[model samples]
Target: MAGTTLGAASPALAQKKPEAAKPAPPKLSKPVMAVVMAVQKLQQAGDHAGALAKLTEAAAVPRAEKDDALILAKLKLFSAQTIKDNAKLEEGLTEAVEAPSITPDEKLMFSKFVAGLASNRKDYGKAWTWYEFYLGQKPDDVEITVQAASVAAALKQPARVYELLTKAIDLREAKNETGDRSWYEFRAQTAIDNKMDDKLLPSLLGWVKAFPEPKSYNLAIGLVKQRQGNLDNNVLVDFGRLMSAAGAMTDANNYLEYADAALDRGMPNEAEIVLKEGIAKQLLDGSKQNIKEFVAQAASKNAESKAGLAALEKDAKTSPRLALVVADTFANLKQYDKAITWYKTLVGNAMIDQDTVNLRLAFALKNSGDAAGAKAALANVKAGPRAIIAKFMDVVIGDAA
Candidate 1:
């Protein structure tokens, strides 16, 4: 009888134990879950406007509270991007700002978006305010500092730029445990722009000591020395050391300017020596072989040298000022045809002022024994002071013709 009863209970008891007191599945609010699902579907379909509209409606729906802050912030960003309406965008942003659950990353993203929108509308003040807010939250942000400095520069607030850059430099130095050499360069340039030469001198000196090989620093120092009427052997020696360390290349316009300064100061002997030394070092080092091409090109156009102007001309195509220099060099060498060719190129490309090109073409034609071409070129000259001058010169040339 016991065996019979146990067997009878066993099958039912096993089944009942498996089903007894099972925890109910967590109940998701159907309406809220549906709204979230709708938002996700709309976003996935690239219908951001629809997504935001759904989110806005869901935000107003009572009792749909879980993940609300996240959903609202997302809706705000999507709405801001979709509407192109600043008022609505700001409204969304205000909501986001109020959402205490917003993460720092989300805040940064929203702030940048607002700042870009404000900037596009030329609302610089608003842009600055937004950027400032973002920076306050992330104080050591170098990219923001650089951007703020640039914006301040564009706004013509040099003092503000200076302050921002100074702070950025200090922050960078503190973070790296070392001083920033570029900051000194920026300060020197700012001082130059402001005509605060006395301030510039110290900054320049500091940059030179810090970044001696940056050629520009040396050039700045040389300029400062020249401005102070100190173009003596001592200054030359310092420049020479910088040139050697930088493997001074003659092709650089800065080097040419330095040479010209030396020559202008009655130091042609020194200028020649420096050029020779630079050329020798450049040839031996092979670091600045391009300078050789530059020098050869200049010499080829020299009436006394005629070295390799063609190669230089080819390279000059990449540099407008160099093209002009080549043309002038040809003119000075009495290669009037080559000069006229370049001058015509300049005119055809509209690279030079129309009036200037016409006058130069007139002169080139006259010198090339094409008095008629000269007269015709002058005819293209527009009526201005330059045109009047060209007409008068034409009459004189015509009389001679």
Candidate 2:
């Protein structure tokens, strides 16, 4: 048996001869390089489709290793964004995040991108996760933390939102950074929503101290005061103190907001008094420029007697430019006939620039149970770019006339 095996091996060795090694596959060819360059150029130019096509062609080439990975990743990212496909965007971002060669900065960028896409798609849970991951890498990013807090608030996790925003505020305060009051405002608002009014007041006061130049703080303070049944001289004095430190423009807006809040809280008489005082002091001079005209019109609409309406009519006629206010006041009072009358006058006189007056008149007429009159009014409004109004009138007339 050993002699037979030796004879067989000798025959096999004699039959085979050693061959020279084949030349290694050639490196990236010029066509492959051109395709890669084209992909890069297209990517830079924001022509994602062209970039993707070139990348696909280049990927088919032999031995395109490192460049293939980069181009593929970029193509995926661009494709997701170009088509507004959030699922694809998140998938691509996840792949990029997991890539072994991706740098820390690139990974951070991918995480943010995924979070933003998730937010735009209203997938707050996914967004929160990605934002948390990004924040883990950049714990000092107050803006990102604030954004996370906002998303959490939208998700109805108020406690989490408060925690995150408090941290962000602390970080910002320590850094002596300013601007962007949205986080502070949101935190305060969330506190109000969560029934933590006591907590809200202190935070709002702190914001006012930190950003004394903004009247928004004063307005917020006034709201709290009013909510606590303190909208009196004391509230005004506090506002005056706040105004002394705020910009003039902001101070004026704060007064206006205070009045508005008073009106909202069923204290219209107080609002009127405050508005009168503001006007008298010239703090709200810019705002009051047209308010007298509005007040006269409102008084006219609310008059019990025709004699009173006549007096208001006389005032409105004296200031024909106040027709819009007169129309709005009448509309608010549910005096549709009177509103239609004023709106028509406005339309006839070209006092209102937009077709809104005609559309409003139509609505008023309809609400007053005069569908035919509304259609007629719309027909008379032949001008003022409101073909849509005409079309709407046709529909209304077809249905109810």
Candidate 3:
């Protein structure tokens, strides 16, 4: 390394002077400055009433043509807070903030009051606008973020509603939250409201896993029927069966439609089963001519198959697997006598999950009018998640025979 002489240093090698300081923010006009100082003094003196009154007086001063807008905006919030007069606060702050003079921070501060006052008045569209502006300054505030989105929804902006709701759910996910049940319900409800024709099934397919309130599931099945595309009736029957497994096939129309779809698909056996469930529940709407004729046809078909099912019953007693399978089918078909008999044979089997089998047995017995037998069957489901379900059934089964 070479040594440098201090007296003759090159220009580039010279020691640097200290950098200039940043320019200060522009000063307010004299009148605005005076009002600001006066307000500060009043505040220090605990004269909030005086400070507000003075600022209210200074709004008429003309020197602060440039800064007046922002100054007045802030003054409105101060005065309103001290007086607790929300109407004037929102009115004044709203006028001042719309001027170009307001800073990002000032907008966030006063806009909250404006939004709140608007919301209290049920002026949701105006509230949504202010909240949307507030979001620019405090983008990560979850509470405000969701409130903005909700107001957007109330204003009939369904797309914005979903967009913000998803954003909130994503924010929760970032913090390792799996999403609250209410959040999922909100999402599902949004889809339902929009009649989200194409997106309905895919949206609901995951929703019920987290929050399985029956309303959403019911809407989901309705959407499924609406969304069946050009698939054959076989596919519709399969769809109905899938909903049954998901507990979405609850309504009277669902039962009747499932039977019709099955029959149209050349699936007489499936049609027979579904119609039996509908008839037993009186959901075939016997007062309707079409329903009456359809029920008569399905009952006749089921009667023709009665001998075949009886032959299988003999084998059902020898093969417990067959009994369990037949029991599930009969239970679904509402043949409680046959289902009870077969389910009892499988209730004590080591080859099956007996608790699960007993839940089915209890279901058959409950429908069979032997409520006591159903309770006894529930007693066998003493462990696992099924135990709570069995306990629920036990309480509702009513008056054991």
Candidate 4:
């Protein structure tokens, strides 16, 4: 007993509009009109059972014209609605909408109305069908589209939910409208639940770009990292950098992964930086044996690695990978000028991907407080995952870039 009712005044008893604006009502026979009036009076008097009985009698009247049938159907709908008889109301509504006298506008309204009734009854499949019908007629109805997506979700149709909500969200954004936060959340969550990895990044990127909340940033970066499955250490380092820049290093695992990836890539200085920052942020328990081991390992080679950087820079010209490794270490150590120089040195080298070089240069430039330089470098990144990450970084740097 939710105590909910469709409490609006019945359409049958709606006050007539100005003659110029109103469509002509279906002409009812003498018998059907008399029954219709009686049912309305009974409903107004709160005699729902009598109102329904009168409509049932009206249904039996011999109908010579389509208007007679249409009037009878509307009377049944009004009576059924008065008594809150959902089954009869659904039947009456379907009959009324199919009548020859029903306008396209009326049919669309009925589609939405019946869809709501089905949702209230938790008949999601029926609700989805009705909602689809309404949306087919009026695809621009964002609110209804979201409702339909919700119904599709309840029916365990994740792909359909993704399709409907993505269209709605993109449509709103195209109009320069900010969508409701929940819409983005639903779209992202649906992608995650379905393990739609291909869809996850774009879904999250759209969400974080629009909302730019810390929690969403964490999810956007972290979820993709979690699902990427055995990335190259260099790629993992890039992921770690993005997560760190976004302030999305929410757990010890994030710190550990970043540090381990740096260590594996022969960048002890970078590992040391990540481990130290994690400890300072209280996100890593330094007293833990594994963390203690990492801290000591990161420190063991860190100084020696820095000492060898001059020699490394000499060999960097022949090895773009070596240069990138050194650049990443410099960036991690907050030596952004050296990092940017090395990243730029590798640009258009043909031996290494120019997009990678540019994207890395952008990261270093942005860290160095040169947003314009960062954006220029980012603009050169137009291939693979780095391009996508570059797009996200552009949003992070904001319009100032």
- Report residue 242 deviation for candidate 3 (angstroms): 2.3
For model 3, the local distance difference test gives 0.64
**Per-candidate clash tally:** 1, 0, 1, 0
1-401, model 2: which lDDT tens digit per residue? 00011111122211113439863432444666666567668867877767656655655665344433434555566655665545655665666676555557677767766676677677888888888899899988777787788678768998888788888888877877753677677778888889886577566655654555445544654556456553454234223322332332244555666555544433343345555666777877735546665344434333433334556666887576566656655654568788888887777664555445655676678768887876776676554224323443444344445
Q: Model 1 off-target regions past 4 Å?
A: 1-41, 44-46, 52-73, 78-95, 98-109, 120-122, 174-187, 202-211, 229-401
Best by TM-score: 4
Query: Best candidate per lDDT, number?
Result: 4
Error of 3 at 269 (Å): 4.5
lDDT (Cα atoms) of all candidates against the true structure: 0.57, 0.59, 0.64, 0.79
**Residue pairs in steric clash, candidate 4?**
none
lDDT assessment of candidate 4: 0.79
Relative to the true structure, candidate 4 has a C-alpha RMSD (angstroms) of: 3.8
lDDT of 2: 0.59
Q: Compose the digit string of candidate 1's lDDT tens values, residues 81-126.
A: 5545455565566566555655566667567545555555566676
Of 1 and 2, the candidate ranking higher by lDDT: 2
lDDT of 4 by residue, 1-401 (tens): 01112444545422223556667667877877777788779878988778777777666777666687667676667667666677777767767667787667777777776777778788877777788889889999888888888888888999988998898898899999878899889899999989887888889888988888668887777666666567788777777777777777888888889889889988788898899899999989889998899889989888878888889878877888888878877886789998988888788888888877888898899889998898899899897667767877887887335
> How high is the lDDT of residue 349 in model 4?
86
CA RMSD for every model?
Answer: 25.1, 23.9, 16.8, 3.8
Cα TM-score per model: 0.43, 0.43, 0.52, 0.83
lDDT of 3 by residue, 1-401 (tens): 01111121212111123449863454577777777888878877878678767876876777456665666556555555555655655666686668576656556665765676677677887887788887777777666667776677677887777777667767876896656655556766787789765444445554554445456556655655564456566345545654554456667878877788866744456677677676677756667888778877866765655546677677777887767757765765677897888787776688877876887787778777887887898898876435544543454454223
